[model samples]
Target: MPINLFKKSHSRQGAERSLYLAYYFRTPTPTNPVRYHTALVVLPSPSPIPLAAAAATCAEPQSDESESLPAPTQSSPTRARSPGRATSPLPYVTTATKFHAFNVPVNENGRGRVTWEFRVERDDPGAPNTPLRLRLVCLLFIGPLSQNVGDHKLEKILKKTNVEAKYMDEFPKYYCTNWMYEALQLLVDEKIIDPLPCSPPDFWEVGGQYADRWMAENHLQVPYDLPIPCCDRAGVALATPMGPVEEKCPDDETNGNALPN
Candidate 1:
């Protein structure tokens, strides 16, 4: 059975902020190569009131006079609503995960080098109440992996050197567990967190199809009016005259092949 490796660290003060890195991996199969994925979990300062609870509290029946008033113009500034108490603090805590995929080539000896970088940014740096604002940039290097290499050996290597690594799993449908393992080295080097064992969140169990269906069913609005594509798997397979070919995630029509700068 596979287990999730999770370690977390907390800030010394104010609203109780926390950060953790998770790692997992998928072994190679006849049709697919070895892949890894990562989750950088950040618990920012919680709001005094959860958005849903606040909305419920503010919900009121419309009056006839109010209904008769004209709708506000598009150019008019909207008024901010006052915060209300939430029955539970869980609703006030927000979680966001950024996904990345990596495909590595292993030699006959089943060894390969993995290199990658990840940049983590806080939602609001200027807010007075914001807890973590440092821009974390991690460059990773994991020498190689083979059948002979065990978790203990890997952990030792990570402690000696900090490296950064992402990708999806096949059967269990977990994101970048392998990359998360390697990224722990970064936190270790920075003295932010100590390695520990914990279960991954249920939210991490997802794929392209699940994401698309959930968002569509919820009638959620994506920022910048971007269309969300269903990525059934990590890479897209295209057929040419020669043979079938695989490529990176398909290009977004609005953004082209370039990732956001």
Candidate 2:
């Protein structure tokens, strides 16, 4: 996972702060397809730490270069301990992974797309032993064709990689080819990620409702019949501004719009 920290300041009205995690997903397509999925696990309003205290932490003296720094034995009153060895005074500390599959147009004029995202949140930095909260958010778009092209693509990929064969006996009961289920299994194989529950809460149904509320609150016009889920409340503040359909192409590498880190 990539980590970035930044703060935006205004001369007239103090500093405006924001923190986020951007997870990129790719799929097979004519052009390189990159999707950015973000989730906000914690937001401490009114600022959690005083400016002076933050500056002090940053200016703390360090041990000699030859010596190794000891791990934190106790949580700080002003800071939160994220999963792993990192600690942050800011409110946002979360990580995520995303996967996407593009539906190739067989006989139709348009194509469909599906994305699966897994987010883990360390809600209580104070208690490092507590279980981390996990959630899955799935977004689907159907084109002119009524067939489930996204699911077909996902199945083909899983079969090709032999991932489906290994998990055939324990395939999910709901949807065998579910992209989320397969992706989670892959992550579990890699020991880097651990302690994941058998099932994480799914928020696909409420995605659209949250998107609508976000657009309305931002005074943006909702599309008449668009099927894509726009903004998730978890990361609504960090969402990119919506533009006209013709002006936006997520798969276009030459668009010059870099994905936020």
Candidate 3:
């Protein structure tokens, strides 16, 4: 992390910086399945640099045909709708860290259920002395704040984290009301992410002019929001055909979609 980044004009970069900071980290290394969607939550785009800050920071280089391709993106149950840029406050991690949370859709089989992926990265990588630490923080303040704003857009359990903090509470005690807006504020102050128009039908649109800066600097795609934007809505609402009640399928034995043993 560059010391000069703390300058007021560079604050917006903090949000973006939070994300890219992860690539440089090697957390304690988890024993869990390492849920896949957690992987897609992009940290700010950052150029892949060698271990040392002193090394020349090269932009992400093009890959050769010989190398194995990157893994596919996975989904996570924990997520939040990104409100536009920095209208609200987002938390800033001044130390090395990765945080993550699991979010289940509101309804297990219900139609309106939504599951989102969220994360945050740190600006620093601590040396062994501190061993990098994590804390469980929450909002005792939201209820009052919600009353004033009259906006209850937040889904149940609105905790925020990066990949590393995903399990910190388990080892000690954990739960948090940390939200993305706090992260956005850091960017706004830094000038990395400028607020943008809320997408149609969205009460708030969240985007940044420089959101892509980290990715550009790092030579990678900009991080996407949960329920990532997809142009193809074809199958999302397609209804499943119904089968005759109490009737055997003509090819039940051969059909794979049919209920299994």
Candidate 4:
């Protein structure tokens, strides 16, 4: 499938660049279903003038449904609890890149299992802009379908990937786009990796500031240890009639009132 996005960064209007990325996951059988999450972060390239030039000149059609998706505000089993943003240790990609992922389940009986695929492409394939190239990183997360982080099944799946040598032996030492901090805890608990590598104090100060601002405006979260301010609770627990009864709070007994006090 193809996705389209518009590039509107004024600063890069004079430069030209384009990037194409394809990421995919495979399963042993079509019957195996898994909950998978994928992310793409565009870091600062050593030089970005060509990219800027390409973005400025590239023109493409937009999707009939061109609206951007809403950010995730809570956790879920079937989808990402957080969304990724475009930024990084270096300058971020200013042009809009059309990126999308699919979790297709193939099954004979209609009870299909899921596989992950993420693809990113430029607006103009024939443009003379610099080709967008960057690193692709991977992490193992704990989800409803992927609850067993260290399961042999997972190890087998990971080994199947043609990742670089560093990723095979040590924990990821680089950065994240949009991440759920809690997932990192799960990774640590499973002994998948040690403490996330730390950057120098000043570097973190600058990077974290830029990243946090980018994330807030974009409604995304990085899967790192940095603390995020919790949203205020509504204090109203909602339920449906067909749903289970709400558990009575101890305060309800003390107040001698019903209806959840």
Candidate 5:
């Protein structure tokens, strides 16, 4: 859970807005005691932005490279791309579970990083108090649009918590919010985050500890045979652990399927 949506409508340009999927979870990392990870960031602008610039907007540590992403600077927001790469409008970037922080990188020259033709898998280590990991199978950009009032109301409960306003904005719009909600719902429907309410983002605020307590109290182990979501698209098979190591794509699928392909 901890699926909080923060909206930051382009302060000046309302249509050119950004939605952030702020995910606060506890991990074993010492430096990240209370891991406040932004699982997914949906910046559905009228056009694309530079991947480097988009990456720069994030303040949280990047868990993709096994090292922290360089901080963004006013002069040069994100890391500079190698020569021959053209910077333009960017799409969305989703950092799934820590297992493989960023399964897909933003297309340096394409519209986005992920497409609709992607698969979602839940990997259970089969350990107690251990939550299953969410994996994004495709490497393209999937944009978001609109806002969901229902979710907006539900997150009101989190206001009482110390979670800052800057953390909870009007980002992640409806499309990205719903997409992430559905993904988390899969975990709820599967009973992974059971014995604990899985609906509210507040529940997930300290979800890591909650899951640990549940595991100790019930002696439950994360099962491996979870009902996962997968799809197939012609010419684009699901990538393996070590394949497609490039950022730029020749055939862009930024505007892909709504659901899995």
Candidate 6:
């Protein structure tokens, strides 16, 4: 009985260890994003329109005043141009839902941040291009964390999001990496930003919140027409600066897929 009593105290003396086990086994701390979303969309088209909703098939018309408003047009100037000239372009044909809001983050940095790729088309969470975009963004933004985008954890995220693994290396080659990465490389190459230690000139020691903020504040000056520029062999912008990132590859001048790799 006395030996048994000693054994019990031996377990009780380990109470600190028990508590430690409990704490170690406790649920993981929830991660909170450093940035908050603001100003959802750029209003490529005006939203919250006053048009009357019509049901499928036959529907009754609204009141006389309801039908009096002019139809939505893109060419309608959002701002002033000349004395009588129009300022805005013709209305774009958008496939976006009217009720939804586009999410643009106030800042882009946080503790252990993750990038999820998106397409202008597939607004939903699932798509083949998202992981490629995510990995590409992570790499271009910070030179690839925890190995390549094809890593196991990345594969899991891609699988969880219903993305395909086949597209791991497939990107627009221009923006094949996505917009943020392109912006990073562009700003860096332009000498608009300083470099990060052990990282590319495009990467920042403080992450992208600073650049995102800078862009957000000054994006009005950016030429929407110049989303991506094609480079010539001398690393200069060609006459036409649109299309795939690899399109500017020196070899692309002759071969298509090799892209000067």
**Top model number, TM-score:** 1
Give per-residue CA lDDT, model 5, range 95-164, as digits (tens): 2222112213245376444322122223221111222222222121122223542223323322222212
Per-model TM-score versus the true fold = 0.28, 0.24, 0.19, 0.21, 0.20, 0.18
Per-residue C-alpha lDDT of model 1 across residues 164-257, encoded as one tens digit per residue: 3322222323224434544554444544443222222222232222333333333222111111111101111100001001111232122211
State the weakest 10-residue window (summed lDDT) of model 1.
Answer: 235-244
The clash number for model 6 is 9
C-alpha lDDT of candidate 5 relative to the true structure: 0.25
Q: Which tens-of-lDDT digit does each residue in 9-39 have in candidate 4?
A: 1121111221111111222233323112223
Q: Model 2 compared with the native: what TM-score?
A: 0.24
Stretches of candidate 6 above 4 Å error? 1-140, 144-153, 157-205, 209-213, 220-223, 228-261
Which model is ahead, 4 or 6, in terms of lDDT? 4
Candidate No. with top lDDT: 1
Off by over 4 Å in 2: 1-98, 107-177, 197-261
lDDT of 6 by residue, 179-213 (tens): 33333344335443333232321222122222232
- Order the numbered candidates by lDDT, best leading: 1, 5, 2, 4, 3, 6
Worst lDDT 10-window in candidate 2: 1-10
Q: Each prediction's Cα RMSD?
A: 17.4, 20.1, 21.7, 21.8, 21.7, 27.6
Task: Tell me the spans in candidate 3 whose CA falls farther than 4 Å from its real position.
Answer: 1-179, 182-207, 221-261
